[model samples]
Target: MTQLSLHSPVGELTISEEDGVIVSVDWGWSPFQEENELLLRAKKMLDDYFDGEEVEFDLPLKPHGTEFQKNVWKIMSEIPYGQILTYGEISDRLNSHARAVGLACGANPIPIIIPCHRVMGKNGKLTGFSGGEGISTKRYLLELEDTFNNLDDNLSLPF
Candidate 1:
């Protein structure tokens, strides 16, 4: 596994990949050490994204998963930057049920790059995020994308 650390608005992220495919992306260090090349490039794109200078990622990413999961990730990859999509919409597109779509979303191997955080429940409700950052972190990501326009005043950010 190859690893690289990236700084973001929420926190520092460590992204890992193996055989040119993303293996893991977590909030902190992992015990395993591996060489990193494209990992560094991913960090750079993430930086540009958080800085609001870049909307889309241009990187070779292969998220390993089952065929169903891969299909879910493909639809997720189409979610334009700074935009949000309901889980139901994804289900409709994939001709699957909403619950199944949610399951695939929770199993997303890559978060920011795959843009899994852009998926939400019906009516803009925050849903599950498998990166283990919790709902607050998920909300922060949505806010960064300018998709959470109805957050409470206290939760509103200056930027």
Candidate 2:
């Protein structure tokens, strides 16, 4: 596996890759010391994302989790870069329940790639983020994507 470290507003990120596919993107409690071709690409991609120059990611991903978790992650990836969803909405999509979706979000191994931050509570409130970073980080990311701007002004119940 190859690893690369980069900086973000939340913290330093360490992106791990295996077999040429990204396996994880983790927040580092300490600075990571490694670099490689895959890491470079990951850095560039993340930079572009933070810079608002990219939306959907095109890098190889190798998430390791249960089938349900993978499904949740897949749905999360489908969320537009600037859009957000509620746990209940994801459960409806999966024919499951909000608790189940929340569990899946908590178990998300790939954060930014899978886009767990894009998930919010009903009423467009920033909710749980299991990345150990906090919902504020999630909000920051969402705001970066312009998903939160004017959200307060357009407060209409979706369901």
Candidate 3:
């Protein structure tokens, strides 16, 4: 595995790639000195995203997880760039309970790329985020998107 760490608006991010596909994005620095086309592309896409540019990552992803976790992550990838979804909503779509969906989300290997931060609790309440600064990072991401329904009401933004 080749790991490259880059700084982002939230914090330092370490992206790991193996066999030409991105494997995971951890929330810290890793000292593996290697870079490839795929890692470079992922870094560029993440940079564009943090710059408030709407970006759809067009790279290969190879997250390791169970079938159910993979299914949940796949559904998460379909979430719009600046849109938010609730665990209950995902559960309904997958015919599973909210807690189960939340578990899968928590187990996500790639956070921002897979967009587990877009998932919220009922009433758009903030939930757990297994990333840098936890829920704060999640809120920062949502705020950065600046897609809140009512811009006038700062608190109206979905978390």
C-alpha TM-scores of all predictions: 0.83, 0.87, 0.92
What are the per-residue Cα lDDT tens digits for candidate 3 across 123-159? 6778899888988898888878864552335334333
User: Candidate 2 clashing pairs?
Assistant: none
lDDT of candidate 2 over 47-133, digit per residue (tens): 888777755787788799889889998999898777778899999999999888988998887788789888877777677787646
Model 1 over residues 60-112: C-alpha lDDT tens digits? 77877889889999989898877777889999988899999898888887788
Stretches of model 1 off by over 4 angstroms after superposition = 31-35, 149-159
lDDT of each: 0.77, 0.80, 0.86
Question: Which portions of model 3 show Cα errors greater than 4 Å?
Answer: 150-159
Order of models, best lDDT first: 3, 2, 1
Name the candidate that leads on lDDT.
3
Model 1 clashing-pair count: 0
CA deviation > 4 Å runs, candidate 2: 29-34, 150-159
The prediction achieving the highest TM-score against the true structure is 3
